[model samples]
Target: MSTEESPVEREDRWVLNLRGMSVTKITVDFRLMLFLDSDWEVAFDASVDLSYGTAHANPSVLLSPESQGVAGALALFGANVVSAVAFKSGTLRLVFDNGHHLTCSPDPSFEAWQVTGPRRWHFASLPGGDLAVWTGSGASES
Candidate 1:
């Protein structure tokens, strides 16, 4: 008996855009491992403008205390607040209200992520030279 082999393929990519006075967009390319449950790898591009405000500002405030705390911690960490909060490394770290912290890191080859707390948004340079907004949640708008 002869057996057939399957070929590996690239995964699908998804883009999300939130538009209003401020515009936010994100594109994600991910591969799901068919053999493993809940196993996946992803590349993401995100961009956001907090000049306006988010769709869920009030709700976001109610749901995230970590947002407020992280803002303060970021200031202490010497993160520049004016135009956009920016850090040196590929990893962007923030602490939530509950004291739980989350870090987002892009691949080393990609440009560093730019975060703006005063504007309450972030963006990264995509491989294709496009910008993607960060939308992890608990982001505030000034």
Candidate 2:
């Protein structure tokens, strides 16, 4: 075999890296705020779903900030995120190490979700159902 080094493959689909980052804080008010350990925060005013693994796959959908659905996300406090991904279609999904999953879809009229992270990285779901992504280096719209 020839000795050669290959370039590291970049992840084009994933917008945020939450793996191994625990949820440090959660604020439920007019909007939802999920704070990660490493200066990462996600805020959204749109509907969100929390699925509790296979045994309880279907959980109540959070429609508004006053719906008391905050109880579901409370379980994630201090829970480490196993995976977090954002699709090109402006859909966001987060999987916790506790086997719970959270999802947020784009809103037609309002901005669905926004994720801000370290190094000035910002990703958001546009009002028209598109994505506005800004990396540490530059900004890219999708």
Candidate 3:
């Protein structure tokens, strides 16, 4: 066997727009993290969160805190994800494992989650590409 190294593909943060992305996996922890591939990763770290108007239209989707146990967060997982859409109102739409579709609106007063209480909501690749996250801490119980 020949010894060789393959290049790792990475997206430039300065030019990435996460909309319409086909996410392979997701993990819940200090951040709502997404793995574009084995080597490309992006996340919504709550510590530096800028958006906080999180609202949940459905709980079964990516915003399922009931499914992500804080005591044992490592077990949390997501497969076959669709990055969906983002609205100026701060609502982000997504499709998670098992075809769960949800819209999240991050409100700072809702005990607003960040990885710091956070979730990977949407990333828009526009004139000045943008990224958004929702709180993973206070998922709507209703």
Candidate 4:
């Protein structure tokens, strides 16, 4: 589909404005889930990179439960999101006010990450690198 054909639709990439939303809860089972202020829930199945406490000077910590450094993700608890952006290639980048930055990329053969938010807005990184998005209203889908 094309934007000209549907004004409410987005191309392949989009940004999520999650500023001011704090991480209220963190859950780790088969996947890592971060709840934001009771409004948004983000789940990551693929590897995630977390940069905390001097972002530019320090290397990001990998937070894949199957691997080491997953515990570093806990630092995000109660941290407010300063900016969140989703790339067309299925990358979710989130910057936190506490000098933390998180990035989740899509997996080649599996759904990597997803987010559910207020007003029934839902977005996911599909297997093989694509985006699937749904919103409560046509206006919000963009």
Error of 3 at 20 (Å): 6.9
lDDT-wise, the better of 1 and 4 is 4
The alpha-carbon lDDT assigned to residue 47 of candidate 3 equals: 21
Consecutive 10-residue window with the lowest summed lDDT within model 4? 1-10
Local accuracy of candidate 1 as per-residue lDDT tens digits, 1-142: 0021211111221121111112122222221101111111112222211111333542222111222222322211221111111223333333322323233444445543343322233444433333344444543221
Candidate 4 collision pairs: none
- The local lDDT score (0 to 100) that residue 112 gets in candidate 2 is 85
lDDT of 4 by residue, 1-142 (tens): 1112111333656767577888999988878899997478899988998887666689888898544337888888998888777766778888898999988888898878988876777878777766777776642322
Q: What is the C-alpha lDDT profile of model 3 across 77-125, one tens digit per residue?
A: 4434344344433334444444444334454433222211113322322
Against the true structure, what is each candidate's TM-score? 0.24, 0.82, 0.36, 0.81
Per-residue error (Å), model 4, residue 72: 0.4
Rank candidates by lDDT, best first.
Answer: 4, 2, 3, 1
Can you give the lDDT of residue 87 in candidate 4? 68
Candidate 3 weakest ten by summed lDDT: 1-10
Q: What is the C-alpha RMSD of each candidate to the true structure, in Å?
A: 18.1, 5.9, 13.0, 6.1
State each model's CA lDDT, in order.
0.26, 0.75, 0.35, 0.76
The candidate with the higher TM-score, 1 or 4, is 4
Supply the TM-score for candidate 2: 0.82
In model 4, what lDDT does residue 42 have? 90
Runs in model 2 with CA error above 4 Å?
1-12, 55-60, 66-68
